[model samples]
Target: MPVFNQYYYEPLETKDVLRLVALDPATDERDPLSCTIFQCRRSAQRQEYSAISNTWDEQTPSQTLEIRCDDDISYVRITANVDALLRDFRAREKPCYLWVDAICLDQTNGEEKSQQIPLMGRIYGEAKDVRIWLGPDDRVTAKVFTLLRLLSQVLDVQPQWHMAERVVFHLNEVFCRKDGVVGLKSLLNFFSRSWFSRRWVVQEAMLAREAIVHCGRYSIALLSISLAATRFLSLDVASYPVNMAASLREPTTKRGILELLWYFHEAECRDPKDRIAALLGLVPNEKRFPLDYTAHWTELYRQVASLAFGLNDRAINFQLLRVSAPCPIQEMPSIRRGSLTGQSLGNGPYLSFLTYETQTPTSGILPHLNGGNIRFSPLTEASHGSIGIPQSAGNGVTESPT
Candidate 1:
């Protein structure tokens, strides 16, 4: 028996230089996946390549792939998800250049991983195309893609149609058909895929110059899927990970890093620190937290809270604190409990104050506070508190503050 040579990554020379895998085309389905790693400067013009946006399927055991580096043929273990993607690409007639994180980056080297992770936005953004892999096609994949295409066509035809009108059209034209029911269920299943909920895809999709979603042999423009999602999914029900990519591209709905964090909090990542790191690219450099995977999760959380508080935008700050749940790490400061008036304290200790009111009966609607002079002073110890501002009753009259 002959032992296969093990592949090893050459260290990236500079921050601007990264690896790209050139996949060797296979004529037979049984052929092993083969690729060559080569260095490329990200800043170089006229470099055509596609980057993959995918969820790592860690649940499955790893599989080996043939990698030709320099003069020797070597084998490297890759996740099952990546193996599937490579196989799909390998079946093509011509060789293709691709930036797949799992294979292109040196996963074992922490330093290399840290450096490459931050550059991912630029990597995807600069690429001629971004391919989103939602794993291989399943039973409902064909129906979902067909439904997306049909919906996208409807949207393209009536681009200016109002939301209500679009909903009506969907109900009458799309949903009214016999197969439409099955298609709708398939669409639901499609959106429910793990790919949609992955944290990294948010930035990947948002930054791509052009993106195509690939499932097995099926492919479609990401814009088509986004448009279909907007037209079909209700605003309240749609998860930010699945729905916010298109909105983020729009100038009017552009959000800062803090807002992005709040919206994409539920998006999954293997590392908790990545919850902050993944969205850093979308925000301006000044607003970005330092990209340090080595930092403790609590430290990252604190930095986020600190940055949010530093902004001193009452509305944004209020929203930030209101939505923040108690951190699982107890040592971390509770910014929610710290500031009542939502003012910057300049690294001073934060204090919390709770307001209570007597119960008044009329309609079920709670009374809104009109005007009151509330005093605030810094306290020696930190604590958590809540301020309840009830909804305004009819007649536009607000209850006097007690």
Candidate 2:
């Protein structure tokens, strides 16, 4: 057996340059997968290619895929998830031009990875459209797509139906039918895929000018899926799937890092630091915390805490404490320590202020000093509004301080 050469990446000439892969069309299903990598200037003005957003399935076996870097043939090991996606592309009639992180960036080069990480938002946004691979289709894939198409049509007729109770009731009635029930179940199964929960997809989906979701051969516009999810929420169904899709439709620039972190707390990433890093794209001031893969998780967490506290927004600061308290990083102390003080905590006045606030909750602080309260009212009540309640005895149904 002849040994195939291992592929090597030539250093990217400039910070603005990145690699794109041109997949070679395969004549037969059994033909070996092959692609050619070439450098290109990364900019939104160049819309010659699509970017791929996919979950890297580490549990699956890796396959050796061929690459043509220049005049030499080389091979790289890829996860099954990527292998399946490339194979799907190979089956297409024409070659696809794609910006796939695994293939385009030199994973072995830490410097290259770091440089490419910050450009991810632009890379996805600049692409003509983002292609989301949800792995091979299951039995319910067709049903899920069919139902999403129907929901999209309904959304087109009336885009603002989510807030209307009558329309929500009608949608519930329609989807509760036998066939619709089956379809809804299929939709649930579809969202249960790993792709939806991956931390990075949040940014990829939000930044894309257009996005197409692929499950094996079946492909649908991501907007259709997102609209269907919105309809799902108007019916008062569980918001697991809706939470994943609905936010993608919103402008990424409006949300802050703290809010993004809270919203996507459950989203998983391979690297612990990526819990914060993945969200950089959606945040307005991404430069506030630059991407540094080499930094320790504790260092990153402290940097995030400092940024949140530095904002001087009381609501955001309190919310940050709530979000960071349960974080798995043990080196950082919680409010119970009287102060979030330590080498990792850094020396900031906000820490001392937070410490004082934590201990003085029972000292007759007003409702505004705390993070406000949620008021309960009967379903028949006409006017539902929030009222401030002082921290005094005999206050009717006041929320306890966190």
Candidate 3:
């Protein structure tokens, strides 16, 4: 293993520079779990390991836990959430190699963190499995599982639950009754879990080759929950139905990095910039903006907008901004801030334009010519009917409109 030094560790010869935790196979479950760090090259050599994705709670650091090693007892502090996850992992019958960011990374060393943070995508992507810890199981979790299972059966008939009228009929008949209200409430609470609202977990979940979700003693495949959530939300029931369209609701399926950043803006992070950094690897065009830990937050935001506009400059039009409220940041340009505001990036009014039943059509409007697509040629003071002038050309001095 390479020793940590200065602002950067010496670059390894290979792409694999990960730290794995080796658990003790000894007795005394009550004692703090013993762990040792090991490093290896992942791309050159294949190794089986599971990566744990979780939030570091505030209370856990202050509360010290005791660990007994070789007849010596010492107290160490860890986040409550991580302490629980480690305890649960240690209780398993077979010992396994795991990579947990909170323990594996030297949090105190800013230099080490700067080097390791960018590799987060590779770390989770290389893992054989990514275990998502959503705290513990409770009544809400139990009910959520039950509801999702029922939704799966309904969705089996049609992947698009909204199109399956028969399933909609069945759901109303079978689960929307007086007693089922309790289950509906549970579904709402289930989606409200802090795990779904996290920015870091978005990348962690997206990059995993395979993943599982653990809640207390109960465990389920990540795919199962995602599929079930998608199906349940797809059922567009009129009454007593889950509002899948809620801005903060987590999508039941995978989303790109930009979408996740926009959708989960409410997610909590110790550093505001992590809101952008955490999703770097998961973006579809991640290569466009390489991860740079030293970049300013404003610069990062500009980089994202610049790349997006580069792909389609038509995105710079003001029609996209018309529908959205003014951006909260007065310092940021409206064009850049409105990039994620659910606006069309093409040279036309939004597709929703036609859907507005109450909107009145203005007279003299060209069939397809709206303010969005009408390009005006530059006109000099001497030009009479270049482009800014009306179709009635009152002068013979037209220079081929060049």
Best by lDDT: 2
RMSD (CA, Å), candidate 2 to true, equals 11.3
For model 3, state the Cα shift of residue 262 in Å: 3.2
> Candidate 2 lDDT, tens digit per residue, 1-402?
135476778999888998988888887767888888888876434438889999886655368778875577888778888888888766456778988888888888877877878788888888899999999997767756776776766634444454444334433454565334554565667788888878899889989999999999899999988877766666566445567886678775766665666566567788766777788877776435676777655455556655655665454455334424332222233322111112112343233222222212332333324553322111111111101112222223222222
TM-score of each: 0.72, 0.73, 0.64
Off by over 4 Å in 3: 1-15, 26-28, 57-60, 63-76, 91-94, 156-179, 235-260, 263-268, 309-402
Q: Worst lDDT window (10 residues) for model 1?
A: 366-375
Indicate which candidate wins on TM-score: 2
Tens digit of per-residue lDDT, candidate 1, span 202-242: 88988888989999889999988887776765423455544
lDDT of every model, 2 decimals:
0.63, 0.65, 0.53
Give one digit per residue, the lDDT tens place, for model 3 in 1-402. 112212222343344476666665545557756554456766667558899998765454744434333454444456778777877777445565788887667666555666677788779888889998878899557546655556655534545644445434434544555444555555667667677766687768867888888888777777666666656555543222122213222432444434555454455566645867787666554333665566544445545554544554343334334333322222222121112223322333221111111111233342122332322223233332111211212232222212
Model 1 score (lDDT): 0.63
Q: After superposition, how far is residue 47 of candidate 1 from its true place, in Å?
A: 3.5
Clashes of 1: 0
Ranking by lDDT: 2, 1, 3
Cα lDDT of model 2 overall? 0.65
Give lDDT: candidate 3, residue 48: 81
